[model samples]
Target: MNEQQRTILAIASRVMSYPSESSAEEREHIDEAVDENIESADIRKHLRAALAPLDALSTRDIQEIYVSTFDLKSKTGMYLTAHEFGDSPKRGAAMIKLQKIINEAGFERTEGELTDYIPMLFEFMAVSPEDAHHERLQRRLANVGQRMLNHLEEENPYYPFFTLVMTKVFPNPTDEEVARLERDREEADLEELPYPIMYQ
Candidate 1:
């Protein structure tokens, strides 16, 4: 990827990360990214719209909202494979493959964070040199990313952020792919799986 693409991916990684109590700094960073004009017009618009409400909320409030949205709600999960494979053996296999790719790219997993976390995937994309490995991983992530956007509520603060991030790394899915993703999401939801606990 080019410099501008790398920059935007880095910004998106931060925006999608789990925020601590100090979210004002994160919001400022996002605002600055929006001003940079590195992203396309649609992405810029969505980024601005997503941040507007978040800018007004306190750090605690933002944390609560995030927890309620992603944690309390199963539909908006952060783990890419979880949405597809749930807690089945297939999900474990997928996670292992992702971890292998991350390791091959010289990326280490954070203490308790999973390889499938979207922000970490973005971070990986931002720094890894463009090559066959990156391209293959990007394709895999794009599939999951499309499904993520489909499941997320459009009005949620993180929705536009995800949309902007996914669009940057992945091509928009076709109509048939969209239909398949919808079906996959529904099937995944029906499985009795343990919820993933976020690293504190």
Candidate 2:
């Protein structure tokens, strides 16, 4: 990725993560970066619209929204693999491979977060030394990302930010790939057990 793309991904990763007291200052820095480097009018406009409401909210409010939106809602969970694999062994295996890829690129997941967390994916792509695998990973996660967008309310502050990631950062996944995820979702729904068990 180019410098502008990297900057945008880094900003998105931070913005999408749980908010902190420093979030306001970090947002200000993001705005300055956008003004200085982001030349595309469409990207600039969409990014600003995405960040505007987030900027207005206090850190605590944003934290509440983040938790309620992602943590509380199973359908809107931030772990991309969860949407596809639920608690299945497939999910664990996929995460292990993802962690290996991230580690190979000199990036590591934050404590208590899964390897396939959406923001971590963005953060990894932003600074990963190897560009060869970025597009491959983006395409792989595009379906899960789209499912997340589908679950989120259109007016949610993070909606447009995700739209930007899906449309701009990740290349469009093939129709077959999308259909496969749909089938997986259906199968997982049919296989839902009465109670949660290890490895699903």
- Using all chains and alpha carbons, the TM-scores for the candidates as numbered come to 0.78, 0.84
Best by lDDT: 2
Report per-prediction Cα RMSD to one decimal. Answer: 4.4, 4.0
Clashes of each: 0, 0
Highest TM-score: give the candidate number: 2
lDDT of each: 0.71, 0.78
Which ranges of candidate 2 are over 4 A from the true structure? 130-132, 185-200
Over the stretch 42-138, how does candidate 1's per-residue lDDT look in tens digits?
Answer: 7667667755676776778778877777666555767877766655677788789889988987879777888888778877888998899888667
Ten residues in sequence with the least summed lDDT for candidate 1? 184-193
